[model samples]
Target chain A: MSAPGAVVAAPEGLHDREFGPANAGKVGMWIYLVTDAMTFGGLLIAYASLRRMGNWPDPAEELGITISSVATFILICSSVSMVMAIRGAEMANRKALLGWLGATIAGGVIFLGIQYYEYNHLVHHGLGFTTMEHGNNLFGSTFYAITGFHGLHVLSGVIYLTVIWIKSLNGRYDGDASHVEIVGLFWHFVDLIWILVFTFIYLL
Target chain B: MSEQSHSTKPYLLVWIALAVLTGIEIWAAIAFDGTAKWATLVALAVAKAGAVGWWFMHLKSEYGWLKFVAILPIIAAAYAALLMAEVVAR
Candidate 1:
């Protein structure tokens, strides 16, 4: 595979690094994200199979689209904030970096709050983990399994962003923005996964 | 460190496109029915995911092998989706 920037031949006696023109940390994160994607993919496939087996209720009726759509919009906004944070790091603007990173973290916190509220509302309406009043129990099971797993991801992402934000405040990324870029990759992946989850679990 | 210049315009444009596609997705979900609805929603979701991967995740600026690394799971997911189709067709 061709490297991104201009290619230069190594001097006669020197061996080049394994990952040419790519940061090792970035590649490692990509690998981790691939595995995580597969996990979500497996869960979604199973959910679809179970859904196709019949006796499934309409998701729109059970889970209101309005609230979830709001959550989805918030995630998309957070993704933009993440991009800005990376840009800030690249430009070595500490204030911009901290501001955008804080915004991203706030977005995550709000998302989790909305999820908690939604879960509580669902449970109050009789959509328990193992039982749903006047509905198939599997709906509750698969719904929570997929969404709850994603919720955990969001929760972790918030924590991850918080750590990165704290480090940014400490000037850890002033000279090198690679770590911020790596964390940005993880954040964007979470948002990407949510795009799919929203469609499959809430809209479909 | 060498100074580098980056533009936020592209990112902003991508954000606008994503937001518009999401709005269309919601409308399609409410207005469309059956196969049309499912197809539209899936297509919109994929488009949104692609935008995030390409622009936000910087895949467009990545190396060839890295792009390959990113696409590996998509192939796997497609296979899994095919299995779901088979089960659904049964």
Candidate 2:
């Protein structure tokens, strides 16, 4: 099918036309999210297996959902701020972008902080990864592995946004406002994954 | 540049609503019992996920190909969910 501008067919799978770096970035993030979703799927499968086998202990005895819930809220808020940052960048309001990006980074840091706190809290409750409360189960391992990987992604994204934020102060990317948009896409993907994580690990 | 409006209000409002929904989730997590809690949590999670995908990620703004990209994984997730139900049900 041909459009108004250019009639370049995007083949079977690849993006049809180059959508600038921002569009490319967003697309790349979505691709990454698909793979990450599979990983979470595997983890959820494992969780189901363990729960079926009667492996998981009581929440009051083993894990803390409240902390995870709070982190979920923080991450969701950060995603909002990230969209604002992208908007600011598009309007060439460097100061507003920086402020929003800084907020995003702070949210990432707070997420990591709370993750560690929850980790320690779980350990204190006698659920430190290797130790199993009810049966010698894979609950802790799967839980830590899944959430740990997600946390690492958030950390890397935080660093990426921070660098983007610092470079914005130097006025390097004047016309490429899509860079922030791409970062927002990545950040939102991270937030989306956490939404799944929070539901599977905590609520269900 | 594309003429897409860059207003941040929709995403922001959705974010606030998600936060409130999360608060309700936590409250229901502690307050409710049995099937009621499970049903509420799952419903809220599905709603929140939809908002994030539609608004924050701008999936609603993109071409159909993007939706194709998104729906494939979700289709796989449906199968996975079936497997989960089978495993947990046994």
Candidate 3:
């Protein structure tokens, strides 16, 4: 024990003790992701439960699989590009980082565009939020609730990526990868949620 | 950190595997019906999601505690599925 009112220093190895090697930002991101996942989980479970109650239209028949499959493939491609962007950041290759990040952003934009087209097409065909021309009303509500929430995520992700891309353009992340990695976590998470959404909402 | 020196080949491989799995999912959806189709689709979707979490999210290389943190939602999902099963049983 130190003398009374003495300013004692922390032990050698105990100083700056963090949650393992992950920085606070990464840990916080993970925690946020866990919570977000639970939200999606709740929605999905509700979807499944309501689906089990019968009168649910065939997803493929109601929402064409071809377009959604294409969207899924695009999202997958964006995930790959995201990994490459992180790799570039890790290697301190500014050009590769910017290029891959740009590609990832492009993928996200195209996805949103496709989603817009799909929503318009669906609405034009009488798939309103509370009414489906050829199926149960719950289908429209749940489908919009799930995919619309995801679309908002994609939109926010694109904006986030755009900000990061601007910072990269300004040479802000030249030698530091922590920020890029943190944002990558969010972007990848959006993709991950989409995977579940596509399966639950469109395929099954 | 040392493993960071590896090339992007693994990412490419994972992407290819995801595409292939998706193709299989579409095919299964078209060719199968009933429990078989549901089982196949659900299995493939879970596998694909796992691949993304394991590789793209770097969960495979993260700390063990972080991995546990990441899997919290899976536990919740399982519970939800169990409840749904009970509902179905009723």
Candidate 4:
């Protein structure tokens, strides 16, 4: 509903010329990120309130944060790799772009691997979705729901990154490289969500 | 072009800080009990989130109005979740 990038009226219609479709892409992605932030915020607030209200055991007693931290590190590094990929693209260094994109994909795979390990570890500790040992309690439901949803997001992001990686290899981004920037925006959004999840679900 | 001019070291440092804070959070959760642990964990979380948002995501480097736009919905969603948590708890 709002005009794109014209929050303030500049004298000579500077925004109208400076901010075209490319700028719109950036702005739209930021708007999408705002909604995404809301989603994570809702999950986190639920986690906080539930933790505060109940007499639940601390997270370490049930789930281990150390292992989750490993996964967290993987995701963080992926963000770095993503930035490198964007830089490479902007520089028109196709080889470096693909290399960094490959690194980013590898980071995603490592993160997913760690998540699988954590899921199995929880299951071994009798913390599955349906087991009463963990499920009979409110803590289990809220914990699983929040973490699982975030995991699903990670999975989806991995798929998205994979697509971008493959495209990069095929020289799909040779012309404009703006696609890489857009993907970088999405990748950063995913990374941002994980930061919140690492805090609320694992660390905090 | 602008991104190239900005050093990558800051982002890397923030990432390392996030990893360390996560480790500290886990340690505190295990070491402390009651409200102390809760307080510590929440504080660490806030700090780490700040690092990620500010540096890794480049929110701090962006326009001030953009940062406000980004955070507004998050605050609103937090309130919605809080209300929902209250209802479910009740």
lDDT of 4 by residue, A1-204 (tens): 433433232335344343323355566778887887777676767666766665766566578777777777788788888877877876777887888888887887888788788888777877766553743476767777877777777777778878877877766665445667667777777776776676666655
**Tens digit per residue, CA lDDT, model 2, A80-181:** 889878877777777778898999999999999999888887777666577666655477787788889899999999999988999899754444466677
RMSD of each: 5.0, 5.4, 5.7, 5.4
lDDT of 3 by residue, B45-82 (tens): 89999998998898988865778899999999889879
Per-residue lDDT of candidate 1, residues B1-90 (tens digit): 233233887888899999999999999999999999999999999989999999899888776577889999889978997898899778
TM-score of chain A of each: 0.90, 0.84, 0.90, 0.83
Quote model 3's TM-score for chain B. 0.90
How well is each residue in A1-204 modelled by candidate 3, as lDDT tens digits? 743432233355654343456766788889999999999898888888888878899998888999999999999999999988888877888898899999999999999999999999999999999998887899999999999999999999899988989989976676567778888899889988988888779877
**Candidate 3 collision pairs:** none
RMSD of 1: 5.0
Which portions of model 1 show Cα errors greater than 4 Å?
A1-20, B1-6
User: A111, model 3: CA deviation in Å?
Assistant: 0.4
Clashing pairs in 1: none
iRMSD (1 decimal) for each model: 1.9, 3.0, 1.8, 3.9
lDDT of each: 0.87, 0.77, 0.86, 0.70
Model 2 agreement with the true structure over B1-90: per-residue lDDT tens digits = 233243765776798899999888888878897789888988888888889888888888776466678666788878988997787567
DockQ of each: 0.67, 0.56, 0.67, 0.40
Query: Measured by TM-score, how close is model 1 to the native structure?
Result: 0.92
Order the candidate numbers by lDDT, best to worst.
Answer: 1, 3, 2, 4
